[model samples]
Target: MTPSNPDPDPYLTPGYRPGGATLPRETPPGETPPAEGGTSFTGPDDSHNPTDGWAAAPLTAVLVVAALVVAFFVAYAVWFVID
Candidate 1:
């Protein structure tokens, strides 16, 4: 038979402390690290302004009122049919 393995299976390991250096080392002071693709949020301000257009509160209120009115009508119809 083959010699028994000393190290346990890495996949079967539990918790944060698996075996080796699983975490990234802290960046040095003043030195700018290279932009990590997708992970890094620091980039061109291409995001649209949230307050550029009409507020969502008005639209949400209108939708809520419409839904409430529809619900009331449905309840009324069901009550009428049952009566």
Candidate 2:
């Protein structure tokens, strides 16, 4: 039989076998994986979730209008007081 080449079978020949246990089958212990239905979803169900501090366009428009009104009144008061 031809010699078994060390290059072809490194693990079988000597001290080169893999060192650790096989990787975990499921997530490691205490890992609290996504809720338990094999569906694996972890967050709110809504697909179009709004961010915490984000506002929609209509709300932003209202805020801008209100700010402009307040600014106009403040500027009018300053002008009236000066004149």
Candidate 3:
């Protein structure tokens, strides 16, 4: 009996043994594995906004105007006041 050459025989191992019966299936090219971690669907909460309806707009406007008024008065006192 002749020994099977593993290099030329797909069914033979090195000396003369059969290889693994199941070969890996051929996967189509360009296919990637799924993402490891699950995806998330969320956004910032609406509580950050401190306004409601027309009242909210006017309230924000009033606060901005008040800040500007205070800034102008402070500048006048610091630079324009008689020394």
Candidate 4:
């Protein structure tokens, strides 16, 4: 013979509770719930182009050249002092 199930419905069993707080169906004063089933988001139309600002290639080239000039001067000074 099959053993009888103590709690046939696990949901109805004692000490077996569902997670999360129980929220009220009623909306707060001066606020209304959405009529639609899913969410509808509205946002501003803005550009997200990363290359909108100053050109990175030109800036990087200028910085590299400046660094090389400074490095050359430092090497010349060290050589002059040693020689």
Measured on C-alpha atoms, candidate 3 has an lDDT of 0.62
Question: Distance (Å) between predicted and true CA of 17, model 2?
Answer: 99
Per-residue alpha-carbon lDDT of candidate 3 for residues 1-83, written as tens digits (9 for 90 to 100)? 99775566543322332444443343333333555675453656667876556787788999999999999999889887775
- What is candidate 2's lDDT per residue for 1-83, written digit by digit as tens? 89775565544432333664344553345443455576568767887866686568878999999999999999999999999
lDDT of 4 by residue, 35-79 (tens): 675545556656774757668889999999999999999999999
Judging by lDDT against the true structure, name the best candidate: 1
lDDT of each: 0.69, 0.67, 0.62, 0.68
Query: TM-score rank, highest first?
Result: 4, 1, 2, 3
Model 2 CA deviation exceeding 4 Å by range: 1-55
lDDT of 4: 0.68
Q: Give me the candidate number with maximum TM-score.
A: 4
RMSD of each: 11.5, 15.4, 15.2, 14.4
